[model samples]
Target: MFFYLITVLLGLYLGCVGMQLVYLVFIFSKTGQYHRERGSLPAGSAPAEPKPDFSAGVSVVVCARNELDNLRELIPLLLQQDYPDFEVIVVDDRSGDECYDFLLLEALRHERLRLVRVNETPQHITPKKFALTLGIKAARKAAILLTDADCRPVSNQWIREMARTMEGDKEIVLGFSPYQVKNGWLNFFIRYETFYTAVQYLS
Candidate 1:
């Protein structure tokens, strides 16, 4: 009886692992290709009605709470996105750091940058959610793009790529956010976990 139980448990574990391996190899590997071909029609298919152009205007929203350093580095990269008509809105959620001052200066210099200052959050409300709400409300564009202050876009055409995927009836578009590579074992583990989560969710 004991031997039979051990064998059954081992088989279950191995089956789960095998299924996960197959999924990673076959399905997860296609994520990049799907992103690349999202808006394209099939090779020989008849032309369908034209989809709406979502890239005409977009609002890039960032909710920050005491994230001055990350914002300082990230804001410049966001401002440099290749999209023609877009605005970057940063919500300062009662930050104790110099984030508010920095955003104020940047907003003055760049007409495309907008700042929403959150002085305080109610006791019952979450700060990040509140900040994001304010930022989205302040947005003047039809499309809202959300990114974290700590994240850096891998390409200047990030907005363009995302907007392209929204051409059809898709109301919500999910994106992948990979962590920066580092030399430590923990970093490697974190990156792997992040990639795995992206695989499961993005697929």
Candidate 2:
């Protein structure tokens, strides 16, 4: 009789677990699904060019430490953004490499490009957080777009799209950056992990 009771309890437990899994798969859909066109206008007829939102000038902030190579490739992509009235701010956070020199040269060539060279990060604060805070504080515009030095904007309209999310009482916006896929286990695992995490969060 005890063995039969144990078997019954085991079956009940399994049923509960199965039901939870089914709920996750069918009911909860938070992070699992994403709206690709959430902030973008419908891509049909050519919409009238949006009037320059003077109140929403953007400051594009990038924090770098010893990333001269990545900066070279990505900075130009940022500087050439098709949006108007935005500035690109690159904060060189105590980099030992040629990052400062490169930024200095770039700043000279591009009027909208500015550089902030930090010689040291305070003991109480971590280096990256300090650099990011400094960049945000230094931003001239009310709107700020923060990204890493190594990141490349997928489109010239990247800032435009991100900025659009700030409309109508929205202060903070979150974005996802997918890693470049390569012919390796690491890339495959990363892709799988991303999908799994999204599913779990959405569920």
Candidate 3:
């Protein structure tokens, strides 16, 4: 009986591993197919014209509970994006910290900055979700981009790069975000897991 149980468990484990390999291969094939299609246009067709610059207005929405320190770094990066038409909306979800006061000052300094204050959250919904909903609704533009307070863009061209993918009928675009590298086993594990999750979804 013990031998039979071990054999069954091993078989199940192998089956799960095989399924995971298959899924990864399938996702990778999709990426290859996309590139191939782009590379080989119809033989007789004229060269495709370059896509125009993304001029559509974009609104970046962020939800923060008590992330004032991180916000101080992230908001400046967001405001400095090189996009022509965009707005930054920060949602303060009843933070006990100095977030409300800081956002008030930022709004005054930058005409493109908007603030949404959330004093009460419903028992049925998460605070982040509730705050994001309010911020999105308050957005002046149709294209809404969501990010966290802790996230920092690597460059000012972040918005432009993201918007470039939204040309044509594309409704959604996902970008890669690896965790900041730190000198600890926990940080290493977290970064590895984040990369794995990004591969699983972004492919």
Candidate 4:
């Protein structure tokens, strides 16, 4: 009798777990469908282009803390952005790693690159947010673009697309970042999870 009771409880637990997984799958599918529909608008349906006026200034701010590996990979990409008139500001939030040193070296190599190191901690604030605020305050351009240290733009036209999209009192522009794919079942699961997240946000 006791063996039969234990078997029944185990089956019930398994059933609940299975049900939860099914619910999550259902939610993900719905979200992906919505994102696809919204993202598929025709190019001609976009807003009309604004009059040609030369806007030469832009500032790209990146916040980092103990991100040596990421800095090594992304700094060159930032410096190489095809934007004609822009500055790249890397705000180092008291990184204990060698990222600061790396930034110094890269700054010397790239005239457009600037480094801002915060040596002291804020009394009561998040370091990343504080660093970003400082970067914005110190920016020399009217337009400020924020990106993570690990991120890289897909092409030279990234800035062009972003700049052209801003017209007629548009305050915010939505952008999408694609994730790198890897091998195995875990990668498949992660991709599915990312798709689900994008769906929720886009919807």
| Tens digits of per-residue lDDT for model 1, 23-46 | 878887777656444476688987
How far does residue 178 in candidate 4 sit from its true spot (Å)? Answer: 1.6
lDDT (CA) per prediction: 0.89, 0.85, 0.89, 0.79
Give me candidate 2's TM-score against the actual structure: 0.75
Kindly report which residue stretches of model 4 are placed more than 4 angstroms away from their true locations once superposed: 1-56
Q: lDDT per residue, candidate 4, 1-203, as tens digits?
A: 99999999999999999987886677645544544322455667874455532384778899999999988888777777777788889999899999888899988988889999999868798888889989998899878888888777887767766766565576776666666788999888978887666665654
TM-scores for all predictions: 0.77, 0.75, 0.88, 0.70
Clashing pairs in 2: 30-202, 31-202
lDDT of 2 by residue, 1-203 (tens): 99999999999999999998887767656455655443655668555555534568999999999999999999889988888779999999999999999999999999999999899889999999999999998999889999997678998988888886677677877776767778999899998887666556545
Tens-digit lDDT string for candidate 3 (120-183): 9999998888998999999998688989999999899898888777777878888888899999
Quote the positional error of residue 162 for candidate 1 in Å.
1.4
lDDT of 1 at 113: 97
Ranking of predictions according to lDDT: 3, 1, 2, 4
Better of 2 and 4 by TM-score: 2
How far residue 21's Cα lies from its native spot in candidate 3, in Å, is 1.9
* lDDT pick, better of 2 and 4: 2
- Give me the runs in candidate 1 sitting further than 4 Å from their true place: 1-55
